[model samples]
Target chain A: MEQIGLSHIAITTGILLILTGLWGILTQKNIIKMIIGFSLFDTGIHIVMVGVGYVEGKTAPILDEAVQLKEAARQIVDPLPQAMVLTAIVIGIGITALMLAYALRLYQKNKTLDIQKFNDLKW
Target chain B: MIIKIIAIIIGLAILLMALIAVYNKKLIVAIVAAGVVSLFASVMYLLLSAPDVAMTEAAIGSGLSTIIFFYVVNKIRKNRKDHA
Candidate 1:
């Protein structure tokens, strides 16, 4: 039984990455680490979506009648995930870039990157 | 059964890496390990048949984020040695 195919591995890895990212966010004292955690979390979700598209031995979803369309479709991998991952990849980059800019600004304001050290604004 | 075992091993390794990222004292090490964790996750994505995700993971997770982190650390550390 090939029950444990690629999706199983991808989903498991994605979940693990999210959990690890959460753990990092909760335990780390640095803002940069927290950002890193966030990135990991984002990666986890993206992978999950992409993994959902995988069909064992399926060809890329494209218009092709040379190879019986119906049977080909039976084995064709979903195209939706590719589109979703494309969107997600761009979004992830945007968020990371923004977060890095924020980190830089925060460092400028506080002169340190330690989250614990920035308690002046907290009532 | 064999594929299941392989998946289990990969999952366990990811868990271990997560733990190390959370518990490691050095910030640099944690960031690097986090990148590795993402890189490994990308490979797992490939295993799961998501080449698109695998490509994204390789690019953003391991590539862009790591560079941004290195810059953030260097920028901050240059001024504050104690925090470094």
Candidate 2:
């Protein structure tokens, strides 16, 4: 019961982070604010993924003195999520850089940060 | 037990900072607050037993991203001043 409760705490926090990021993305009008929101959203998803992979009272997946190869399957937390998150974090940085470049270009063209002002694509 | 409580507090701080980053009228304040949010989230990742993620978040999310933002903002301001 205690183990489950503790794990739930992590998961709940991840969910809350996700909600906060979503709110930022939805409400903010500035392009830079929107980029910040996107980064938060990416971080939130990574947290949730890592939180879900955590097993109560388990060590990291590294095989060492504390955690042996024989008991690794049972004793180590899931490594797949951690691996995926590693890739995701790098990819998130790349995507954010791209978004910021776009924001810079937009600002250069329009001389404003307001998203509503970028109406060239709007029909 | 205590770690879990600390994690929760950090999570709440991240949320509050995210809100401030998004809703603040001043762009510079919002950008700085957003970087703080990423920094705290990296700490939360550590508490969640994701040291690699924490490092990456700190380096890329908090460090590089904020620097890039400030650089772009500076360029934009310079361009505006030149235009004016």
Error of 2 at A89 (Å): 0.8
Retained true contacts (fraction), each candidate: 0.50, 0.62
Model number with the top DockQ: 2
Model 2, A1-123: lDDT tens digits are 355444576677678777877888888888888888888788788888988988876877778798877878998778888889989989988898898899888888888989888888999
Number of the predicted model whose lDDT against the real structure is largest: 2
lDDT of each: 0.75, 0.82
User: For each candidate, what's the DockQ?
Assistant: 0.47, 0.67
Give the residue spans of candidate 2 off by over 4 A: A1-4
Per-residue alpha-carbon lDDT of candidate 2 for residues B1-84, written as tens digits (9 for 90 to 100)? 777788768877887887788788887898899899889978877776677778888998889888888988888879979998
**How does model 2 do on interface RMSD, in angstroms?**
1.5
Worst-scoring 10-residue span by lDDT in model 1 chain A: A58-67
The CA lDDT at A67 in model 1 is 50
Task: Estimate, for each residue in A21-121, the C-alpha lDDT of model 1 and write its tens digit.
Answer: 88778878888778878877877787677767777666556546635766766766888887788778778878987988998898888887789999878
Estimate the lDDT of model 1: 0.75
Clashing pairs in 1: A6-B48
